[model samples]
Target: MSHADPDQLTLVALGEPAADRSTSDHVRGCAACRAELASLREVVALGRESHVELDLPMPSEAVWDRITAEVDRKNTTVVAVPPHRPRRRVRGLLAVAAAAAVIGAASAVVVDRAATSTPVAAEQLLARAQLSRLGTAPGGARGTVRVVRTGDHAVMRVAVDGMPAPQGLYQVWLYDGVDTMIPLGVLTGGEVEVPVPAKVDLTRFKVVDVSAQRLGQQEHGVSVLRGELG
Candidate 1:
């Protein structure tokens, strides 16, 4: 794998690392690198303000103001790349943003539907779906995996039922079509979120599986549950 550029490094510093080789090595080595990555992540997160103007078909004067506000909030400016080339890039960004919004909203719908149902519990459904490491006693426990789509980029939340509390800690993984599972990082707790690789075709892994594990090797073990998205 090739090393990431400065921008990729900046994203990694902000808790959003591109799938580059160097950043992973740095993450394994330096504490300062991790702290810097978190700070950048929080800064990018602050730009997630919901401006009603962005909802309009054509950007209104108000929309431009909100856009500027977002850029200013991040201490960055929107670069106007060559119009022809940028069209594809801009469209891709919009698609991912739209997908993320849809996924986030769907989570609420799932909860509402569960509230009306009798069998499945919301926490259990969420855990099985989103949480990577899950273990349960010998009953029919439930869990939910909420994956939001932003273009091809996916973000997911996991909730589990009957899962034994972590002995120490565990991390999440995104399995490729092959046997290898890439580390997304340590779970934040019962509720944690992470960005899925833009390259991962969700359709291929519709029935993605989650497992509970001790953080020794990057192997999938004792999978607790699995579900299909499409």
Candidate 2:
């Protein structure tokens, strides 16, 4: 069966009734459509609790340089490169790489200080999706992921639950669901936020993937969880 239109699903998520009776009927009967609606509903709920936007100064150029260098050292690789293909999104995807670099820095420093520190910006979600358990996943594993813009910067927020411990680490990625993927970062907890390059067009990378990987692994590993962004 054809899937529900994503825009209509978004409308339904925003408290608009489905335009067609069949869409409401279809959501009740189709598992994927149901799941997608549930995910969007969560997005709505999160939006209620999300940060209020604020205008703030970008840190110094030296600060960005160091951050950029840190992001460059991650275990990233290009699994496939099409020499002949035209990619308008190449710049944005690479910026996603730059955004992925700040997961470690942001998650640690921001938690305790947000309350007393002068407010900079609050989270405004740009996009989100539901991560489902793939065949490779254990029965208990599942997750939610979102892209948020705060002031001039953006980050990918990932939260997982019911996953068993892995021997090495769990890593996240923005995948095209085809020949290429960019490592977002290692999953540090049940929830982690990784910086996103301002340039990424979220539509170009439709899939959010999580995999169990060894410490030195540069290649994407056995899939444990995956989902598509709507």
- Candidate 1, 1-230: lDDT as tens digits: 33223344443433433555766786667676566556545434433433322321333343344334433444754422222322223323333333344555667779999898777323312222433333443355455667765443557776656555665454555554467666565554555677766776666655555566775755665556555554
**CA lDDT of each candidate?**
0.50, 0.69
Clash pairs (backbone) in predicted model 2 = 99-195
Model 2: residue 176 alpha-carbon error in angstroms: 0.9
The top-ranked prediction according to lDDT is: 2
In model 1, the Cα lDDT at residue 53 comes to 20
TM-scores for all candidates: the values are 0.36, 0.48
Over 1-230, each residue of candidate 2 has an lDDT whose tens digit, in order, gives 78776645655765656868988988889999898778766544543332522122343444345335535533544222222222222222223333442444466567757766887688798889899998877888889999888888888999999888888999999888779888888997788999876566678887999999998999999888899988
How many backbone clashes can be found in candidate 1?
27
